[model samples]
Target: MLNMFNTALTALNANSTAIDVTGHNLANLNTSGYKAGTVSFEELVTQDLSVDSSDINGNGIGAPVLSRQFTNGTVQVTGGLLDAAISGNGFFTVQGSDGNTYYTRAGNFKLDDSGNLVTATGENVQGWMATNGVASPGGVPTNISIPPGSANAPVPSTFFGMNMNLNALGTVDGTNGTFTAPVEVVDSLGTKHTLTATFTKTDTNAWKYDISIDGGDVDGGTAGTPSSLATGTLTFDTNGKLTAPAADAGSVEISLPAFANGAGEQTVNWQLYDSAGASQVTQYGEASAVNSNSGDGSTAAQLTQVVMGDGGKVMAKYSNGTQKLVAVVALASIQNPDSLVAVGNNNYSTTPASGPVSYGEAGTGTRGGITANALESSNVDMARELTNIIIYQRSYQANARVITAGDEISQEILSLKR
Candidate 1:
């Protein structure tokens, strides 16, 4: 009888453990990025019973908490630049303001006071630093900012490449003759200058006059005569890469006026003057050009503004009206991601199990390139949790019933003895 009571007590304890495990799961059901725990039972081994090692195993006996169970949860989508989610097997590395490093799967981040990328709690985002094409891991990442008066310019080597399709039949009366546009150009010092081009119609199909850029121009022969820059015909191959210059090459090389400094991006005024008899104006927006049908084998983007592709790559315009690569963003990658330790707050740290960190771009390897204003969500499965809860409840009830029946039988035996 005493043995029976002990058996009942053990059953009660097991049931209680199941209840606690289920309760914990329910508590964290709504917790963000919480990996659900699994409660498993292991039967106690008894010397009297010769249990087969491979048959019953430990499934029939004791119940222990299995917190290490990893469930691929459902991810919730949130549109935010700071929100990030890992697609494969890695975690984000974070550094607290106190200089402590932590890791987690969560990727909610924001800009810190010093303009460094940081978490909501103000932890700094960790990654390798890049200068030019080379990169190295560092504690401080300089703020990414666009310099003021950046010299963003129009492209193509030969000036006045894309000439306006002049109306061969249209006539401009000298009384109201005008042609103007705001052209953005980089100066010898790499500064942005806005040049306002003015033109006057001189006669049919033929126009003449001075090209004043940013209010500056060279001697135009006689006071109002632009003999220095002679008028030229507009010729185009099927593909519009300009087959010819808009005006005749001058006796002296013409120096195209450009912006002043080279901090980064600049906006300029591009214009053409009609001094013949009529006035007209034109302007270019963010796009200098798109696709082009031209003699030059360059793509359409080369027809206007500088063209560029992904990463931190960009088409750079320099002083002296030149264009080149100004800057580019670098990406990094890793391996053995499963070994990464998860720190709270959606962060992860590389451990020995994870091996050495391998670097690559976002799209390279398992690290998918990032999308703006889009984030990966937590992987939590609600249906699975509900099912697990039901199983636990049944186990708890069975164990409680066993204990109650044992108590009744023990009472009957005690009464008989009395």
Candidate 2:
């Protein structure tokens, strides 16, 4: 009877552990990025009533959520520029204040005061530093600042490149031969300028040209006359990104306007009339600038008018007139991600069971990068947890009943003596 009581006691202990796991799951059911765990059981040792006893039952199984080590949850997208989600096997590394590395799946990152990109808790995000413009593994963990597009900085850009299609009149009046068309030029601030490319037909399919910009003689902007192409060569790419780099590109160095709002800013002043054309300058509206980029104070502005080249794309441009690319966020994958041990503070620590971290840029390989303005939700199933609760409660009660029955039998034995 005493041995039976011991067996019941062990069952109670196992059931109690299972109940604790259930409580944890219930508590974290609404947690963001939380993964629900499941319980598993292994049988305890069994007694054999035979001439020669055989070892059986080993360690008895109880309800266990520990077996549900990880969960694959659904992700929600918000479409914000800074929001990102990881679609495959990897962990985001964050450095805690304690100087230890912590991992996470949360991608809700923003720029903190120190200009470092950080999580909601201000844990710094990591990235590869660029060496000579080549991104490599040596980048120190640094914060990325939120960029607020400010005033157009003063920088000179020569005729960078321009793409345009022309309609030839086929036959030029030998007596009075001339043709006119518009060509675009971007200034130091990436403002576009329309230069009137002119051709005095020397022959069919060919013309000698002089350029007038914003209707002003751009030939005057440069000391020499605008050079004209005599032979064949004026094709455009589909999306408008140049198929070949634009050459000879003389450049125009336009100065910035002296206004905060830049309300009346123009890519350039231009008007091309068929010969008797009035000298008119072209300027963009307020909505164009606002929609084109975030302002200096980080205002949310919608881009209304989109400027396109041969194709349509408004790539990032910096103060130096150098192209700036929205940095591609990195992602890390693990062969056995479940092996990762969850540390507190919404982070995890890597264990050997998780294997090595495989690094790659987002949206590449089997791993995919997520858009901004989206987040991953918890994987806890309330119904499943409730079922676990019932099983644990019943098991606890059954174990307790076993002990009670054992005590009752003991009482009967004593009564027999009495």
Candidate 3:
């Protein structure tokens, strides 16, 4: 009778644990990246009723073992620029404050005050940061930083080009043939200056050009006066194509002295022809007008936004209409993900049974690709959990009834003896 009571008690404990596991699954049904756990019951030791007989007595059920389902959950598009999700098999590697490494599938990430990409609980996301818009992910990873309010360094003007037609029927050696085009350029200090190109029809099929800047822009220069920086002659053939300056030497060099604002002297290249040997400056009977002009220079710009890009790239946009790669998120793959122990916060730590972790960029090797602007929903199945709950409840009741029946039989035997 005592042995029967022990067996029923053990079964009751096992069923109770199974019920707890089901409840846990139901509780985290909405948790991001939460893997549902299933309860597995193992049979306890059985006793042989008789050495030569085939009859056997079942002892009871042992403790229930909870195993997590490592299958991927459905991806939910959150449309958040910083959010990310894994489409296949992989985990986002992160470093907790305790200086220990962990992995997670929750990618509802945000930038901390220090500009480090971090999880909701403030763990630093590990990856390779970019330098000068290039990301070079190596064997080791570091905290990915995309600093807010950052400034892109200004680039000084190196070259300028224009395509236009200089009137062929204009008066020679006078203002009537002169056409002035103003082009803006940036100095080393990011200061804007207008470089004026003046062309004069000095003779048939020939023209004189002068490229100048405001006198006040250079040291010891008089204010409001044009300081000539370059002078050259252009000769065109009968077909209206430039024939004097060789195609290889179609660019004039403009040398600027030290600026009043303490900017160093720099040389600018003025291109009259493109790389394909096509003349940018043409002598035609039409009115002289600059059709287009371009300069390779820009002022410092502020950071506009940081967003998740394809292939797990972190992209930063600037106010100057430029985008740069900030970093690439790292993904880790384990041979047996089920061997990983859940450390809470939707993170997992590796154990010996999990084998070694292989870290790499997403979509490489056994790693999975990343889905930007999304998050992974919990993998719990509500209907399945509810069904398990009902089954466990029934099992618990049945075990309790066995204990009650054993109590009644003991009372009956004692009463008969009395």
Candidate 4:
């Protein structure tokens, strides 16, 4: 009779634990990146009924063990540039305020006042920084930040290439056949200057060219007046293809005077030949029109926006139409993620059973790729949890009935004394 009572009491305790676990799961159904907790009950050790008998019925129920379900949660789009989600297996490593490292699947990240990427609870996100628009792999991860009010310095114009048609039927003198092409170049100080190239037909199959800058003089030229920086002659074959001024001679080197604001002298290379060995300045039988012009330079620009890529790279877009890599978010993959210890705030700490952590860029090895502007939803299934609650409640009721019956039997036995 005592064994019966002990069995009922143990069963009730196990059932109670199951109810608590189910309640916990249901309560956190809406929690971001929350993995549901599951409970399992085992049979307690059995005892021998007698020395001569083989019967060994259990006397009590064993304790219930609680574990987390590591299954992936649904990913939801949040449309925030800094929001991120893992599409496969891995966790975003963050450093907590307590100076310990924790891993998480929740990607609701924000930029702190100091420009460091941090979780809602103020844990710093770790990543590699990019230098000069390029990121070097295999570096230790650190806090990723974007300096406020950052700006990209200007790049000076080094070369300019043009593709245009010079009228094939134009006059052979400066009287009726001259075309002026204006090209904009940037100096070391980010100042724009209009450099003009004048082409004059000298004779059949021949043309003379001169380059000048507006409001300035070429180096070694008369000051305060428009002066030619370079002069050369172009000759075309009977087939109307440029034949003279060989490829080596097709480029001109010119120097410009210092800017009023103390910028240093600028040197630019003017390319006349295209990659196809054809002169960009072709004397084809067509109207004198510029086809395309390209120059290598940029004015000063400010950082306007930052975006996260699928590969976990953060890129900064500038106002001058340039994009550069700012940092690469690192991910950690554990051999047994299910064994991680949950610390609060949707984070987990490494445990002895979790195995060694392997760190790498997302989408590489066992690490998962990143989905920007999104977050991972909780993995808890409300319907399943509700059903589990019903099952545990019924089991608890059955165990309670056993305790009630045991008490009534004990009372009946005690009544014999009356």
Q: How well does each candidate superpose onto the true structure, as a TM-score?
A: 0.58, 0.62, 0.81, 0.84
Name the better of 1 and 2 by TM-score: 2
Worst 10 residues of 3 by lDDT: 47-56
lDDT of 2 by residue, 1-418 (tens): 6768777787888888888878888898656566565656666666676635765533444444364455556777655445555555555667777777677777767666554567778877665533323444423333333244423243322322222222343345553345455554444443444445464545544445455443132322333344332222222233322221132322223332322223232333111211233211111111101111111111122222211111001123443434423233456667776666777656777787877676655555666555455666667777888988898899899989988999999999999987
Tens digits of per-residue lDDT, candidate 1, 315-366, equal: 3334444454432222334455454455545555666765665444445556
TM-score of predicted structure 2 = 0.62
Positional deviation of residue 244's Cα in model 2 after best superposition, in angstroms: 18
For residues 1-418, could you state the per-residue lDDT of candidate 3 as single tens digits? 8989999999999988888888889999988889998888988877575664665677888888878898889999999999999989999999999999999999989999889999989999998888888877668788888777999888899999999999987888665588999998888988888889899888999999999988998999998999999998999999899986778786888898888998889999988889888999898888999999977987778999899986789998889887778899999888999888889888899998999888889999988889999999999999988988999899999999999999999999999977
lDDT of 3 at 136: 76
Clashes, model 2: 36
Backbone clash count, each prediction separately:
80, 36, 0, 0
Winner of 1 and 4 under lDDT: 4
How does residue 102 of candidate 3 score in lDDT? 96
The whole-model C-alpha lDDT of candidate 1 against the native structure comes to 0.44
Best by lDDT: 3
What's the ranking of the predictions by TM-score, best on top?
4, 3, 2, 1
